[model samples]
Every structure is written in C-alpha cells, then in structure tokens.
Target: MNKPWSESWFDAYAPERFEAFTPSHVWAVLGLIVCALLLWLTRGVIRSHKSVSEGIRWFLMAVLFLSEVTLNIWYVTQRIWDAQTSLPLELCSVTLLLSILMLFFRSRWLYPIILFAGIGGALQAVLTPNLAYAFPHYRFIHFFVAHSGIILAALYMTWIEGLKPTWKSVGGAMLFLNGLALIVWIVDTALGANYMFLAGKPSTPSILDVLGAYPAYILAEEVIALLFFSLMMLLFEVLPGGRLYARSGTYKKTY
Candidate 1:
C-alpha cells in the first residue's frame, strides 16, 4: 500500500495499481468463482433428502476443518508479512458450509454457538467493513464472499437444522477461538506473518482493539460471547418450527 501523502485512505494507492487488472486479479477472481461453484453444489447436497450416516457427516466436517487450516497457512504464512490486515480467506466458506451440514445431520452439542459467531460476526463485518474501499488488491470480493458464506451457513443451521446454544456450547466456542488465537499469535511471531495481527503492526483495527488490550481482548470476547450466545439462543429457540430440536437441547445458557 502506498502512503496517502495525506492521512486519507483513498489517496493511499496510486491510480495505476487500482486501475490495472493484472494476472493476480484474474487468478483471485477465478479462485472466488470456483469457491462459489462448490458452495452452490454443497447446498444441493444439503437439500437432498438422502440420509447420510452421522459418522459420515462428522468425518466430512473434520476434513473441511483440516483443509481450511492448511489453506490458511498457505495463504498468509507463505507470503511475506504485510501491514495490511485481513481475515483468513482460504477455506472459511467451506468451513462454515460444513459446519451447517454437520449441524443438520447431528447437532452433537457445539453447533449453535458456531452458528452464532458465524452469523453475528458476518453480519457486523458485512455492514461495517474494516477497509475504506477495495484494498491493496481487490480483497473486498473475497472478504465479503467468505464472511457472507458464514452467515448463510449459520442461517441454514439455525432455521433448517434447528441448532441451539447452551452454556457449555458458549464455553467451548470461547476456548476454541482463544486457543486458535494463541496459536496464530505464536505462528505470526515465528513466521513473520501477521496472520492474526498479534504482532502489533495491523493496518486496521481488529476486534481485539475494540474489545480491549492484549489479554483483555480475550476476556472481553468471553463476556461478549456469553452475552451474544444467550441472545442467539433466545432468537433461535423461539423460531416458528422446532428448530431447537436439531440442537443439543433448548436449555438457556448463562455466562
């Protein structure tokens, strides 16, 4: 990113960089198209009345989880560190889709909080974009698409799968996200990549900033997670259909 000469966001980039459509732009577009196609196909699979085994659904989710992890590594860690920050773009879409599909087949227990985070965060992120405009590259496309996918997945899980949130579910979500945050922080230190912007060189303000300071952000997230999780449970639990059935239970969760 070029210095704005002033402090403004729009004047930061040179005209050519934004105007020029290069090979990378084309490749990124193609990648996004492929992801869209796959998501569309997965929706069809989910809608089909075929009864796939619970074990099979769990296994599919596991595969998606691992694949998304690997993609994140390649996309960020593999590249030279840049101050421009962004959410991990790799397999977020696949991860959200699989989470929904798995919740539909078997809520097990943790599905509802996942739905909450996926939906709530996506909704907020979409309405209030972090960047002023299409960034260094045209990353808005990927960011919008992937985050929106999470919302879609969460909606399907809640409305169609009837996933519900419990206290245990909320706790699990916090633990999992914080654990991942620690890992990303450590990895960013080692790899010299700002994967989670934990290195204190982020281009834009992160959720951590709004929540609080270093460790405080983690605690703040827990409190917010607890509160939001409760709201999500209330909303989904009272849906017209018995959507709560696809979840673990209709128990009300408290922090």
Candidate 2:
C-alpha cells in the first residue's frame, strides 16, 4: 500500500532520508541549472521591461516568504518546533530573508552582500543540503525552493538589474557575514542552540569536514570567506568588462 499524495506531502516525519549525490540529488541540481538557464535567457526581457521584472521580483519574494512560513507551520503542527533548531537563524535562512528584502526594496546596500554571501551560501546548501527529508516531501521542496530563491534573487539583481559589486563590496560582505555570525553565536549560547553551526559543525558531512576542528574551522572560514567573495567579484566584475563599465557609468550606483 502506498501513501496518498497529500499524506506524503504533509508528513512531517518523512521516513525517506536525503542522500548526497544520489539520482535525486542529480535531478535537483539539473533543476537548478535549468532555472538559471531560463533566467539567463530572459535577462534582456527582464532588464528592459520594468513590469515583467517587478512581477518576477514580487513572485520570488512571495515564494521565499512562503517557504519559510510553511516550514514553521509544519514544525509547529508536528510539535517539533524547537527554539534551538526551528528558528530561521541559519546562514542560508538569513540569506533567504536578505534575498527577499533585496528583491522587495531593491536596496543597493543589500545587493553586494546578497550577490556574494547570499549566492555562495545558498549554492553550498543546494549542493550538500543538510536536510532530513527526501524528494516529494514538503520540507524537501521547501528547502530547495528557499535556497534556490536566494541564489536566483542575487542573480536576477546582477544580471537583469545590472547591479555590479566592487572590490570594496567583497570586504563589506565579509564584514556583514562575520558580524551576523557573531550575533548568531551569542544567540546559540543563550538558547543552547547550534545555529549556523557556530557551536559545532553539522552532524552530517559538509565542507567544514575538511576545514579542521571546532574553533579552528571557524577561523578557516574567515580566510575562505575573503577568498570566496573576491573570486565572486572577479567573476561578476573583472571578467565582465568591469573597468570599462565603471568608466562608462554603466555600473552606476543604485542609491
């Protein structure tokens, strides 16, 4: 006997566990690639048409917002809403919120951080999701959708809105991330939570697996963040006629 579609979708304690690099993972990655390709293909239309761009922006905002809301609803309904773990305090969750604000207000200050940290963090989450639920589960869908929305939001701002980040923006993003991490660390201490993996690394294998132990891995992340943000700048800025665009006022400040 098989579960009805509705039962499986809403089952909070989904028995299926996500395995990394499985066929399901490959399909999920393919889906994200298709989404990115579609966005790239429509860059011109989105850029030229304000109505279409704003519609996409609002739609993304709603999707990201609902992703978070419905997850919390499921947690509460299932009686598993632990403050220690259920709160939206993880790095990707924070990035999801920033992505929503970035789309909603089109904040230039928020753009650089989202472009670098938002995309970087969300991409990592998509690649090696630290999630429990497998495909077709609501949490599975919510996890991928929320993370994908973060990456899409940043890319839309960059490709469609022509928001270009400078070298200074790399450092700014690092500062913003570290500051937020510090705050999360404090909250983790107060609540005995492991938000952001600040108190410890994830139980599952992750990029941190190779970074070293505990506090040392935390230090390694600081160095990696700087390098990662710089590389992001190089790809988005330097490789894309950055100097010429700057001189030509094509990369004009939004604010």
TM-score of 1: 0.53
Model 2 scores a TM of: 0.93
| Residue 252 C-alpha lDDT in model 2 | 60
Q: Give the alpha carbon lDDT tens digit for every residue of 50-145 in model 1.
A: 363234344445544544454455356547324433344212342465465555555545465456656555555554445433544334444555
- The clash count for each model shown is 1, 0
lDDT of 2 by residue, 90-192 (tens): 9888988888888888887898888888888888888888888788788888888888888889888877777787777777899999999989999999999
Where does candidate 1 stray beyond 4 Å? 1-110, 132-137, 205-210, 240-255
Error of 2 at 169 (Å): 0.7
Over 4 Å off in model 2, which ranges? Answer: 1-5, 245-255
**Residue pairs clashing, model 1:** 162-243
Return the clash pairs for model 2, or none: none
